[model samples]
Every structure is written in C-alpha cells, then in structure tokens.
Target: MRKHRRIIAAFLLTAVAVGAVNTPAAASPAIDRGALLAQHPLTTYESGAEVGSALTAAGFHTPSSRYGVSLHQLVYRTVDAHGRPTAASGLLVLPRTGDRHLRTVSFGHGTSVYRGDAPSVAPDDMFLSGPAITFASTGFAAVAPDYLGLGAGAGPHPWMDVPTETSASLDLLRAARTFVARQGRTLDREVYAAGFSQGASAALGLARALQGGADPWFRPAAVAPISGAYAMRRVEIPAVFTPEVTPKLGAAYMAYLLSSYDRLHDIYRDPRDVFAAGYTGMGELFDASHPGPEVIAGVPDSVGELLTPRGRELLLHPNARFAAALREADSVCEWQPAVPVRLYVSPGDEQAVTGNATACRSSFAARGARVPAVDVGVDRSFSGMVHEGAELLAVPRIAEWFSALAGSH
Candidate 1:
C-alpha cells in the first residue's frame, strides 16, 4: 500500500464575534476541540481486514490501558433484516476519559462506491489510527461507525438514507454514553453530528429526523452539518462529467444511485462497448465494485443518463413514496436542540447545491433555530475551512455560544 500523506487538519475558532461585536456569546472560554476528520481518499483497493488492524494499532481500542486517555474501539453490530436501512455499526471509537462528562462528536463521511460500507475505507482501519485517536488526543470522545455494510461485510451501503444514519449517529452517541457509564465513567448526553459530502448529507438527514419528530432520546444541544447533500432529490446528474467541478462531484453520485436502483442499471450501459467489441456487457461490471471516485470518474456517456429506470423504481417504491409523503407532510428542518444551530459552507464548493447555506438559513429560520453562520470561500486556511468543521470550530465558540444562552452541554 502506498503511503498517502495525511492532512493533519488543525482548526480552532476564529472571530470572537463578527463586526467586532463584543456580545456575551462571543466571550466564552477557549476549549481544546481536536482535529478535523473529514476526507475521501482516492483508492483503487480496500479491504476491511487491513483497515481494521491499522485502527487497532493506532490506540483506538476501547477500554484501553493508557493514562490521561480512556479509549474504546470495537466493531458494533446491527442487523438490517427487513427493508429497513443501514445501522452505523462496525468499528466504533472514542476516548477513555473526561472527568467532566465528555461532549461527543459523530462524523458523517463522504462517498465510497460500494454499498456494503457506509462511507467506509479498507483494512487499514484508520478511524482509530488516523483521526479518532487525534480526536481523543484533543479531549473529545468520538463515535465513528460504518453506516451499514462495509465493516460487517454486508453488501451495499445505503447512501443518504435518513432514518438509518440518524439512528446510527444518535445511537452511537448513546452507545458511547452507555459504554462510559458501564465503565464507571460519565459523558454529557449532549452531542453534535457533523459530516462532509454525502456524510454531511447523512448528518443533515439524521439531524432533521431526530428533531423533526417526537424524539424518544433527547437530541444534542445543536446540529452542525457542513457541505451536506440535503437536496439530492433534484440534482442534475446528466449535466456532470470530467475535471469540471460539476462532473467531479457528479461521478460518484451517478454510480451510487445507479448501484442502489437496479432498474436504472442498464440505461447507463458503458458506452465503451461500441469500441470494445460492439459490447457484450457493461464496462462498469468489468471494474471493481468499490465506490471510489476514480473508478467512476472517467466512465463514458452510456453511463451518464439523466432519467434512469432504476431511479424510477426508487422514486416509485413504497418506501420512496413514504419518504415523499414524510417530506411533504413535515416540510421542515428539525433541529434536535431547543438551543441554536450553526450552518457552515464554502461559496466556492461547486460540488454543493448552489445557495445551500442561504436556503437552509431561510428554511430553518421559520423552524426556530438560532443559526449563526459564516459564508466563506472553500479556502479556509484555518480549521473552519471545509464543510465538516461546523462543530469543530464551534466548540471554542460553544462556550461562547452557550455562555450567552446560558446553555448546558
């Protein structure tokens, strides 16, 4: 395996308050929130065995022996028997101690071609070896789960499924709390779910679901979903192709929805067949099934249809109908906390639905969320740069945000 340099993303809070406004909310103490753990690596091969061990060796194991560090790392299990969606099972990681009931952070990951893993990587198990331990080093317990198939070796990761990922997010958080409590440690039930790319979409969906209805378990103090795919239902996949930002983002999306909806599979027959012998089967079938962007990045037009039959099946399925109805019936962004929410975005992110932050702010405002957002370019040299650091930067701002609201976490 080639060694790729890991970008050690160190993001701390900036701007006590905009306009140099010295409000009480901007005057909170600086908390040592850890590093950022959001990025989709470009890989041609992935094996759970390899990734898992890497995480283990990184000191991501649960119930650890290290001091000033209480860590637990293990693969959580969940069964998706019925037509239900994935559960964020597999490879859970967290820090060992927080005398002051630790605040938990659940990360939503980006695209992986295969469905068996929800935004999963290979055998290296870098969640612990890479970011989870880094997070622990920063004094925060982290819960990172394989959305469904990947770690457990299940087939197909259910990308962008709301209920499944949402529960996974909250359940992981709940599980972490329970794990600590069982070990005679305590954790602040208050948590925040954050993600980037599709994982960001997952985080957004989970946040909405948890808060949109009568949640049995009280939700976190706030939601900080960045670079999310909140508006996937109406994106123009046909308009994407190549190095242009449009196609770069559209490639995996094309493969993902196509992989899920069998009906649409044939519509995107590999155009290469014309030259490859007048075609016998799809060129895609010849490629590996991992959901990496590279595999899908350079495919031909036959693979890039706008209206696919499989999409029709997904659109017409009973659950699909239920989704439409639920969306129409509720029609609101459900924020779990009665407190405030902080939406973050980069203006130059061509991968995102344009004006997403604006639309979100407008829509969420009517729903009663105190959202203080910063609309910046995609080039944030500091920690709050990308779509994943919503809460990362907010931790410092939390003491600031909560201090003003007199909130408790």
Candidate 2:
C-alpha cells in the first residue's frame, strides 16, 4: 500500500511537471454538474466561416500579407455537445515562414470589463497587445479567446466563476483544432497556457476543467500562472475601496463589481461613479481616467469621476462580498496536474496580497507539483524593477522555466 501511494505520488508529480492534473480515482462534483468536454459543432471549413463575422465586429481582422508572412484573424463561435454557448476569436498573427512544428499557446488573457471604457474590451482583443503578439512573434501558434461574454453575447464575464468559462475555453481549443484539421494543417498539442492577472484565473478554470473531467484533448502541455489568484478569499475588493488603494485599484474593483453584479446597481455608492448615469452597458468606462497600459502615467486618478451620488453610497457598502467569491472559486491544488506547474508572483506586489501565491504554492506542494515560485523582479534591482517590474521580467522567465522543465520530460 505504501508503494502504491508512492507510485500515485510519482505519477502526479510527473503530470504536474507537464502541467496536467490527473483525474481522481472517484467521480467529482465539478464534472457531474458542469458542461463536460466534447467536440465542436462545426466540422468542415465552410461551416467554420461565421467565426470571421464575429471577429470583424470585435475590431479584429485577418492580416493582409505584410513583409513576406501572412496572418489570419477571425472570431469563432460554437456550441459544445452540452449546448453551452462557447466561442473564440483571435489573430493567427503571422505568415508561415516555414513548416516549423508550429507550437500553440492559447493565452488565458487577463480580466475584462463589460462595456463602458476601452480597457474593458476582452483581454484577447488585439487592441490590448500584451501577451498574444509576444508569443506569436516567438514562433508559437498563439490563440486567445474573448471568453463567453466580453466578445460573445451578454451578461456575466463570470470572474473566474469556473464552469462556464472553462467550458468555453476548452471548446475554443477544440474548435481551433477542428479548424486546422479541415485546412489540412496540423499542430502539436504543445498547446500551453500562460495566464497573467485575471488571465491566470481563466487558466486555473480551464486547468480544473481538464484535470479529470471526462476528456483527454483538453489537457494542456504546461501552465504558468503569473501573479495567479488561487481562491477568491484572497481577492480582497475592499482593500481597493480604502483611500490608500489608489485610483487605479479602486476603479478596477468598482468596474469589475459593476459588471459582475450589475443587478446591484442600486446599491452602488454612485452609479455614475462606476458607469455613466445613463449608462446601461456592461464593460468598464475607458476615459481619460481609465487609460490603457499598466504604465504609471496610464494609471488614472479619475476612477470616481463618473460616479453618481448613489454609486458612491453603494460602493461604500462595507459588507460587500465580491472579494469572497473570487478567491474561494478556484482550487488549483485539489485538482492535480499532469504537467509541471510554475507560479510567478512578485513578493512586493501591491495589488495581489503576498499570500495569494502562498496559497497556490501550498496547494501545488500538497498535490506534489514541482512548484518554483519566482519573484517578479520587485526585489531585484539587478533584475530591474523599472517598468516591467513583475510583468516584464516574468514573461521571458516563464519561457525559460517551461523550456527547462519540459526538457526533463
């Protein structure tokens, strides 16, 4: 029996090393309740055409051949076998230079807003260039999804709510595979996910969905969660509400809640504070105050500029519960990984409490994940904090780390 436990542990460690979680011996509730993984509704190239229409509306279009390489851009939609509305839209961002073993990295993009401001655009939106293009430039078949709502239809971006988002995510990849297969092109399951900020939330959601649920193709080659949020309990929105939290922090929190729980508009400190008074939209209000980019100059002081009196009152509600669900929603450790797991978080990050990474590390450690929690360059002036502090330094380190671990396999 002791030898058997050691074998199970060894297999789990191997799986974690590869970023996959082995399914449990017994059936789990998440699988029993949510939409299980299945095939996409579309099978042929002609049927996959409508996805282009969705892409055009989202301000993304296939690249006209430039400088020798060609790129394809389109929005894709499909209903899973379970009938959940799963959709994906992203850029193929490159012209095939050669027949390289086109590696694919389906980025789990950061969090997004409902409809107000510009930044609220889905994280996968090309306008927000960060990770999608970076990986594409490095020779990976990068795929990004607008999730279910940010670019899909309406209501509930889910905020790491798991079930729906994971379903949409897994199916999006399945859809991509189907699209590629129809074109007579092939790509490796070298398929991986690098989730940052809110994208980390999406990554974990998809990871849990693939861990042991009834499918095999859903497995990711490796997963790296940078400044990952493990459970909603660590997501403290009230911390952002305090005066010391800064305008950017408060604005992000209020805007997120406004979208996540729109029905509670009446309870806001000032409805206009979050969204414009006449505003009925679901995304953030991208204004002079809500600028793009994480640069210090871009952080706004006017997050509260659009507030209505009632909005302020609602925001001030001390008993708010948004933070609770965000942290409590995920369990990266409970579900073991089949591939290696890597976690990156700055020791000095002001946005996410230090404990967030600690929790994720704890879970990974328990499940036998070969976790190496690296600093985001916050403490290393030698590593350089300047602008990338966490975001910049973390990206390449992620590439290097994954390379070293995968070589072992």
Candidate 3:
C-alpha cells in the first residue's frame, strides 16, 4: 500500500506540475463568510502612483501614465453549485485617466493551484496580472475574480467546475460595478471577456450567461478565449489515458477536478473509492494550501496509475453524474455569442488541444454566430510551445483585441 501510495502521489504531482507550468493553485487562511456576504472591497490601491509603487515592489515594471491605474481587492457574494449564498474574492482594477465612464474587461485567469496566485492576493502569479495591468494602462476596467475557495474565501477551490466559475466571475463583475459607483466612478455597461486555459472556458461561460440573458445590465462587446479546454471529454480525457499526457499534469488536474467535483456533486463516497491507496488521505494537496509544483513532486505519472481500477473505469467511461459534470464544463462553446467572438488556438498547444477551439468554432459557425478561430503562432512541442506559448504571446494580443472593441463601442 505504501509503495503504491508513493507511486500514485508522485505521478499525480508530476501531471499537475506539467500543467501548472502552462496554466497555474494555493492554500489560504480561514475568513468569516458572514461579514463579507455584502460584496465590498477589502482593500484598495488609492492611486496609479500607489499601484505603480506596489508593482515595482513586486518586481513588475510600472507602465507609463497612458492611463494610470488603481487596484482594489473585493470580497463578494456569489452562490455555490447548490445555490447556497457564498463569498468569493477578486481584484478590480480601474484606469485613473479614463473618461468617467470606463469600458470594462473581465479577465478570467488560467488554471492556478495556489490561492496566492489569485489576482486579489498575488496578481503577478499567472502572467495574467500583466494583461490586467495592460487593460488598465489602456483605460479599461479589469475585473479578475479569485473564484470561490481561493484567495480569502474559505474551503476548497472549485477548479474547472463551470457553474461556479461562471457565477464567481459574473458576481465579481457585478461587485466591481458597485465598487466603482460607490467611489464616484462610472463603468460602460458592456464588458469584454477574455481568458486562457481554464480561464478561457470561464470567460466563455460568462459570455454564454450574459448572452442567455442572465444579466441584462452588462451587454457583451467582444469575447476572446485563448487556448481554452472546451472539449475535455473529446480531447483531454482520452489523451490522459495515453502517454501523450505528462504524468505530473494528469495527476494535478485529475486531483483538482475530481476533488472539486466531489464537493459540488458528491461523486466520491470516499476518496479511496476513486484514488489509489497511496493518495486517499492527501486531499489537502489541492485545497489551495500548497503550490502546484510542490504538489506535482509528490504525485506519480499517469491518471490511470493514480486511480483505483474502478476509478480508471469511470475515467474511460463516465457515469451519469461524472458525464454531466464534463458535459456542463465542456458546454461553454455550445451557446451562440451575440457579440464578436474569437477563439484563439496554438498549433503547439498540447494542454488545451487545438481541436477544442476548432470544434467550438464549428459549433458557432453552424449556429450562425459571429465567431472566428485564430491560431496563434506557437509551434513548439509539449514542454514549451503547447503550454506557455499562449500566455507569453496570446494574452497581450487579447488585451489589444479587447482595446479595439472597447474603443469602437
């Protein structure tokens, strides 16, 4: 049992480490949810100069005053999967020199295993902060959600669960609007949504919700989801069963999704039912209490090796509940977008599988939605091109895309 445990943990950790390099997780202290249910700011960076100082201190370059930016950390009320009211945190960045009515861009972050990687706590974590900063520098309001259970929120992060991710992100955008107004600022009613990897799926979910009339107050201007995992069951799930996946990445994401889904859907009666003997007791590894690379070091290679026989069976052919979760998470691209939409893919992206974007584009085209798929030019293989290329190349471009749309509208 101990030997199996060692192997399972190591392999899972390795899978996560590989994926973590491409996307991103963390642990956090407990907080009182009751007091923070009203959706308010926990802290604020008073001026662009103050933000600049903080950025400089954090080893980030301070941009010129094209549009000076300020930051705020918010704790807002949202619902869990069951519609139970819960608290989540996020960062709201506003441009100081914008026309009183600032255009908004909701930037969803990629997969992060650390709580500190959240924009509210560590905006510099995902290369995401740079884009948020860019949005602000370009005179846009950037709302970056910490998502539930991360940052100052209590309990486990929901990982890639679509409903929670959508709700958390939308609620943050709502909270940001209120936060802005309370401070004598105005926001343009429309929002440009964008993200990468897990975040890309999240952004699309928000766009779907907004287009579906979940929130009429905020119209969709444009959406850019770069290298999102839209077709998990089709592309990602099958790939994990083969060596095409890195053991570290498979372990990391599986542990994250399974553990998170267990919270929302009660998929596991006991951790031992799904996990190998070695990893049954280590549920805290993905609870945001630890970094992903450290967690990956402890997991073995391959999701199949990390799962029990029954667990492996479920992975290959999911039951109703499991299938439902995947279906829901993967349904981001199914809905039509009323606004302009661009699906960014990388030819080199192994983590997100470019096919997901292509399939998504096809869905949009079939539905007569104004959607176009762009392949960003990253041709490297697994280690370099597939994972980090989108973050390094696509994010800044996404900001520019958002800027153009915002300027036009």
Best by lDDT: 3
Q: Which structure among the candidates has the greatest TM-score?
A: 3
Q: What CA RMSD would you report for each candidate?
A: 14.5, 13.9, 8.7
TM-score of each: 0.60, 0.61, 0.82
The predicted structure with the larger TM-score, 2 or 3, is 3
Tens digits of per-residue lDDT for model 1, 1-409 = 0112122221101111111222233343331111111222222212333333443454333222231332343333232323232223333344433455666556665545443323233323342123333334345565665564433324455445555555555545555555656657666655566555555556566556656552465355555555555544433232233333344335445444444433222333334322233222223532334434344434433433432444333333324443453343223243434645666565555555545555556667766765656553344322222332332332333223323332342
Tens-place lDDT per residue, model 2, 27-52, is 22243221222222211112112323
- Structural RMSD, model 3: 8.7
Ranking by TM-score: 3, 2, 1
Tell me the TM-score of model 3: 0.82
Better of 1 and 3 by lDDT: 3
lDDT of 2: 0.47
Q: Among all windows of ten consecutive residues in candidate 2, which has the lowest summed lDDT?
A: 1-10
lDDT, candidates in the order shown: 0.42, 0.47, 0.69
Model 1 regions lying over 4 Å from their true place = 1-72, 79-93, 96-100, 114-135, 212-218, 234-244, 261-294, 301-337, 368-370, 380-409
